[model samples]
Structure formats: C-alpha cells, structure tokens
Target: MSQLVSLNLPAGTTVPSHADVVIVGGGIMGTSIAFHLAEAGVRNIVLVERAELGTGSSAKPLGGVRATFSDPANIILGQRSLRSFEDFNYRFKTDIGLRKVGYLFLCRSEAEMLDCERSTHIQNGLGSNSRMIAPTEAVEINPFLRKEALVGASFSPDDGFAEPEKVVQAYAEAAVALGVRILEHTEVMDVASADGCIRSVTTNRGTIQTNAVICCAGAWSQRIGEMVDVHLPVTPVRRQIGMTPQLSTPMPTVPFTLDLSTTMYFHNYANGMLLGISNSNQEPGFSRDFSHEWLPEFNAAARICAPALVEPELAQGWAGLYENTPDHNALIGASKTVEGFYYATGFSGHGFLQGPAVGELIRDLYLSRESFLDHSSFSADRFTEATKLFREVHII
Candidate 1:
C-alpha cells in the first residue's frame, strides 16, 4: 500500500490520464466532497492541491463553525454542516473538538435588530431554535457582555466552534480510506476546454483527463475559472484575527458573539479568547501582517461588547484572505458558460462552516444522488447577467 498523506502515484503512474471527477483544491471543501463521493461509491475521484492541505483560508480560519445565519439557504447549509460536525467524532473516527457554546449576534441598531428579527423568523421556519432577545437577556446569556449599549440580540444555543485542522485531516484520511486520490503540492496550471465542454486539466506534472472538475480553490477560483474561459466574480479581502492570554475572569461558556456596529467578533478558546475584525480597506494582495492599528479598534469594540474580555495583555494575532463576492455569497453549482465543469468556491469568510454541506451538495450533483437540501439558490449561474445577487449581512 502507498502512503496516503503524500501521493507519489507510483513509478510510471502516467499521472492518471483520467478520473471520474477531478477536484482542484484539497481544502476541507474538496476533501469533504471527495470523502462524501467515495462514501457514495464514487471511487475514481482525484483531489489536486497546489500546496499543503488546509493551508489556505481553511487553516487560517478562526475555527468558528455555527448554524446562525440570516439567509434561509445559508441557514440550511449551516444546519446540515453543523450536524456533520456534531457526529464527526464517531462517524469520521476523529475528534473535531466541537463545543456547543452557542452564538450571540449583538444588534446595535433598529435596522440590524429588525434584520435579525426577520432572519430569526426565517431561521425558525427552517427548524432552528434561534430567537431575538432584549439587551437585558443578552447580559444573562453572557454576564460579561455590556448590555446597555446594545438595542437587542439574537442567540442560537445549538451552534458553536470546532478544531478546523483536525476536521480537514479527518476528512482527507477517511476519503483516502474510501479510495479517493489526493495529490498534494500538485499545481493545476491550466484547465482545458473545447467545443463548449471541459476536456481535461493540464498540471505542472502531467495531464489529468476528466469530464467533471470542481473549482474549490477559494480566492484563486476566479483565476482558475478564467483558465476554462469562465468568469467568476470572486474577490479577495484581508481578514485579521487576534488571541489573548489567559484572563483573570473565568471564561463562561462564551458563544461566538458579533458586535454589529464594530464588525468585531470574539469567542472563547481552550486557553484564551480568539478575536478578529474585517478589513474593508484591504488591498488586493496577500499579506499576513497583524495590523497594530486594528488591535486598538478591535479591543475597544470587544470591551464595549463584552467588558470582561478587555485585557491589556494581547497575546498574538494573524491575518488571512477571504474570497468575497459582490453580494457576500458563495458561488456554487455547475458553471453555465463551461460545460462539464463545476464550481463550489467563493464562500467569502464563511467557507469553514459551509464547506461540509457544500461538499455534500457537490457529491449529490456529481454522483446523481438526491440532495437532502435544495441548492439551486446558490448556483453559479446566479451571477450571470440575467440573474440577481443574493446577500448575507451577518458576516464575521
């Protein structure tokens, strides 16, 4: 048997001239799709990653996996993916370190609160037991929260966070056990298409002939799509996260909370708290530098939202890039312009939580299986000139 971690494909392997399906990214989304597809009896699947597994935005995530959302489609996807995370330990035979600390979305304005009210109604319609609570009740949920400044809040008791790296590795290992080939550090330099259909993909190593291909390359999916002459409206934005040392106060089962006005979010970690804020003025390039100016802004916001988390000792921080779209929604489903080619990327900042369900949806589409949830709303064709944009505001 060959090592699954790093696939050499044996001597004279011929680079697998063809596969039943070719996945162009080895992040959690790609690995999960390959895993689910193999589980569904699609064995001749190949996943190619230009770099290491989970090293992209997947690895740089804040590890917050929750079902709290403002959109029904996203709510459904989040709920399904959350279930996968809940049963991951026994089902995948690996610990995802899931903690159901809950998610508290702080509403700072009437508009935000009304938005929360509407979204909460849709969430309840989808069977999620989330509700809008007054600022006073917000303090009850987290005594550390500064309730006076908030107008109202939304809370989902069932949602929480998990270990991202472990989960991705689990998916990769299980997918391999089920016979899904993963080619690490394998750069897919070109995607070939002809007569309005995909023929194969040409990588640096060799040619991979396949009728079906999925672009899970996150921020780079836009570039990958261009290789096949398909235009994807995904753009990259910088997001920064920070960590604090052990505080004096006992961290109450703190749920992932968002300060709506400040665009700051913080959650409890094993040793301390992980915090971050979105950078709207980010340049169109990759830079992992932890901004010092953003620190004071985030701390000030965190202190106002949750006073107990405000501490002088800021331990460490890092930054990552998100593949944001115009409407802040992911581009899913088959490409309308390119035949035999599919896409499931451009998840913006919510890729980690949505990856599992997206994988399941991709599996159903490729294997001709019935999906547990309808995904037509997220189809890539939605970005066509004939279609309108769908947006999700509650991004952290």
Candidate 2:
C-alpha cells in the first residue's frame, strides 16, 4: 500500500492570506478531502476549522464501517472505505483501532426479514460478502442475542468498527505533511462570490482569496450553504448513545448487532457494552445535550434483543448530531448555482465511514477527472424535481 509522508506544520502556525482551495470543516470529511486533494497535486490547499478536529459528530460516532447496504452507491463507498481502513496502520503509521468483528442485522418480523433478503441480494450482486442466515446461526455468531426475538438475520463478516478521532488525526497529519495547511480555531464567517463563481472566503481570523470552496461542515452544512445563497436540505438530528459498566465476565466476540425492528444497536467496547437506539421523536436541531429520558425505550429493546444487557447500569452516555437529508442519503457533487462551490455532507449518520471515499469523489469532481463510481444519485440537483428518492433500508 502507498503511504503519505507527513509534512505537518508547527502548532500555532499563522493563517495564510490566500490559498488555492479553501475547505471548511476540520472533521473527518474535510481532512479526508484535503488529503486527497493534496495527493492529486493540488497545491496551496487550506482547511479551516472552528474548533479542534473531530470535535463534532465525527468524534462521537459508533465508528461502524460496513459494505452491506441497500444502495449500490453506498455499498461501493463503504467497500472502498473498508480497504482504506484495512491499510491505515501501514499507510498513515497510526493505529485506528479497526476491528473486523462484522455487522449483524437481526430481523424479528417477516417484513424485516424480507427487507434484509432484498438488501442482501443487492449487496451480493455488487460483490459485498453479505448473506442471509437462520435465527440459530445468528445466535451462534452472537451468543448474547435473544434467539426467540429473531426470525432471521443478515450479516457481513467484513464489516466492523474503528476509532473516529484517530482516523481524523491520521488524515490531517498526512494532509499537512503533503503541503496542505490546517487552520484550527478559525471560523468561516462568510463566502464571497460574484457572477455565480466563488472568489474568496472570509474567516474570523482573516480572509482567504480562493476560487474554490468545499463545505464538509456536517450538521452545520445548511448554514454554510446559506452564506452563498444555496439552500442545502440538511438538518441536524440528535442521536444518543450509552455505555454500560464493565462486565464481570469476558466480553463476547460478537459483531456489532442491530435489532432491525427497533433500530437499537450494541457492540462490545473494551470490557463493557456500547449501545444506542434511534428515536423518531428527536426534533431537528443542533442541541447535543445528553439525556437519560430515553433509557426506558433502550432498556425495553435490550430486553427483547440483547437480554444480557437488560438493566445494566449505564456508566456514561453522549449525544451527537446527524446531518440528515429527506432521503437519508448523502448530498455530494458541485452546486448548480454556485460555481466552484461543492458540498459533501448530509450523510444522515454514516459520514464517518464514508469520509475517505467521499473525499476521493470530491477530489475527482473538482479536478475534472472521471470518478471511479457514479455519483449522479447523490447530486444536489436530485431534490430539484418532485422525483422519488432512493432510501437506504439498513439505517441504525
């Protein structure tokens, strides 16, 4: 595997007055884009972040990475990302804590089983190693699961999880080593464009003269787009996660398991269990305050799906934002209204896993090179018409 030589700048470096390309957001997505752009020989690239890198939703993800998806686009992206993670330690010289324990989707109803079958068929056709399995087999893979609640399941052994913060640091350090400049604690105040073309970007520290800007702001993407008069259909939805006290027994070697009926998921973390459940009642906003109000719903689902975790003392918890779109798919590609302005946000809740692939895709689009995968499905213009959008079925 190829590796990028580090050229990181000293800490507290001054911000430059100009750059060839100015990328907003220092999270995983922005750093990935910056690294790929530098690899593509784009000189004088600058990445500006309002806070420390990975402090946003990227730092708080479950870190699940998988190729099993109902959509071919997502499957391809996930597969490519998995490859990157597999080579991360050697390529970036950093341990990302990648574990290939796999992903298990338990289906309790016939309708859910059918959905899994359909998704498995689509995934298998696209070279994904996902397959449908009987309920007994699911228990064999994850002995802690309640077999009575699952009629069937779909699983992919290639799926796993990683450390999101480590991934971000690797990308940022590598990008800097390749001549990319990173400006932390710098906020983009406004974007200046004329005649539908980007000219420069204004930040609280200073202004950067550039012809291109890529918004990878995640949950704050809507506000970033508003600076240039483009309406981004992204909303911030709060998702909470809880961690249980260390178990007295050894942790199970089970995959990251999800109950399809309740959208509850859990996986072993160190000696404890990390768990979370999707809440439809979560209002769209930017508030990330963690709450224990959803403990009842989580405990109920745990009793049915993962009985061993029932009534486990919750030791810690957190809330993070998901940049969601109407279709729950990502928004990528260039904007029609703003020339030289591009976006690669709105991954719903899967941005961390897709960051590497999306970065390459954005680099290809910006450099006028043919992309490795078709990105028309994720184009921003898809929402222009009243057409039905493609939705991913395996969302947790």
TM-score of each: 0.91, 0.93
User: Per-residue lDDT for 93 in model 1?
Assistant: 82
RMSD over all Cα atoms, model 1: 4.7
Per-candidate clashes, comma-separated: 0, 2
Model 2 score (lDDT): 0.87
List RMSD in Å for every model shown: 4.7, 5.0
- In candidate 2, which residue ranges exceed 4 Å CA deviation? 1-14, 387-396
Stretches > 4 Å off in candidate 1: 1-14, 247-250, 307-312, 386-396
lDDT string for model 1 (1-396, tens) is 113465545434546888878998888788888888888888688898887788777876357777777888899889989988988988978777888888999998999999989998999899999999999998888776887889999999998888778878888999888888888767898998988888898887789888889999988898999898787888877788777787687766678888888888888876677877774556766665667666666767777777766654567777777888888888888877778788888898888898889888988887667897777887766666544333333331
Residue pairs in candidate 1 whose N, alpha carbon or C atoms collide under 3 angstroms:
none
The ten-residue window of minimal lDDT in model 1 covers 387-396
Pick out the ten consecutive residues of candidate 2 with the lowest summed lDDT.
1-10
Best by TM-score: 2
What's the lDDT for residue 117 in model 1?
A: 91
lDDT at 84 for candidate 1? 88
